[model samples]
Target: MSETVRIDSWLWATRFFKTRSLAKAAIEGGKVQIDGSKAKPSKNVQPGQTIAITKGTEHFEVIVEGLSSKRGPASVAQTLYQETEQSRSRREQSSEQRKLARAAAAAPDHKPSKKERRDIQRFKRDNLE
Candidate 1:
């Protein structure tokens, strides 16, 4: 017989989410789905199932490969599933984009001039109208 585990417990055990409660919350919030259908925290999960989880700006697509009832080390947790190639590529691309955006937004060594500050204030004030 194939092994099955609760969705929340599996998520927590695999380290896809930090805590079981958080995993439950995400499931309740509709941030986690199984086979393209929304699932409850108590839903049974088995190997060969596809799970999609959304957290903040990232979405993960994973295929369950194993089942575990206990949370374990990172290496052990990593064996629970395989991340989809598209998901991995998207995550890397998004990370690179965020890094570029952050670098662009960070002011080098120079402080804003008085005129620049006034312009910013004026722009904000104009937008508030």
Candidate 2:
């Protein structure tokens, strides 16, 4: 058998996605690329190749370091690739932003009355539309 594997399989086996279908969806959505080119779920992947994947505001650049046909523990899965420094920095920044957002949301100490709460809900619904 060939040492290379399907892109979707590799993504799942390496724990980039929760399932094969999700990995396929990411690939089809252009969120995953190989060597800077958008890749398909059926694309063949080999060891030592680089892949870029974007999830929300986070981008990951990983170089394939090993091959596996099965899903494994996080530690084992992590050994399959090496993430680039840029990717790490981006992840840290995204995390910090999320933390700040959470802190801001929880910072308000005043509790709203029932009427105030209803008005706030109405405002949110109106703004959403």
Candidate 3:
């Protein structure tokens, strides 16, 4: 409820990161940007400013709507920022691509059977010879 709040504190309060320390780490690692430029964890966040956050393969762009330094419930936290439509669509596309890639790269739950291994070895041996 202060006039200004630190970026990391706001991020944690908004539920972007599980802990303030993790938020600080991400900020230090250049994973969070404020108004299109890298920002420090201690940087102040004001309402109406835009922030870009990269968490793993997902990217979120949000405009600050409110500021709070204490963590709140999910519903309350979500109200802290407004996500742009473009950013939402991009995140959906990225998630779909990641799902497809993971499906394609999936291996069997169990190792290959002895017969299958033998066949593979035979094929390799024949090709090498």
Q: Could you say which candidate leads in TM-score?
A: 1
For model 3, which pairs clash? none
For lDDT, candidate 2 versus 3, the one ahead is 3
In terms of lDDT, model 3 sits at 0.96
Q: How do the predictions measure up, each by TM-score?
A: 0.86, 0.82, 0.84
Question: If the candidates were sorted by their lDDT against the true structure, best first, what order would they fall in?
Answer: 3, 1, 2
The TM-score between candidate 3 and the true structure equals 0.84
* Regions of model 2 farther than 4 Å from truth: 115-129
lDDT of 2 by residue, 18-88 (tens): 99999999999999999989899989999889999987777899999998869999999999999999889
Q: Compared with the true structure, what per-residue lDDT tens digits does model 1 show for residues 53-118? A: 999999999999999979999999999999999999999999999999999897757877999989
Looking at model 3, report the run of 10 residues with the lowest lDDT sum: 103-112
**Per-residue error (Å), model 2, residue 34:** 0.2
Q: Could you tell me which residue pairs clash in candidate 2?
A: none
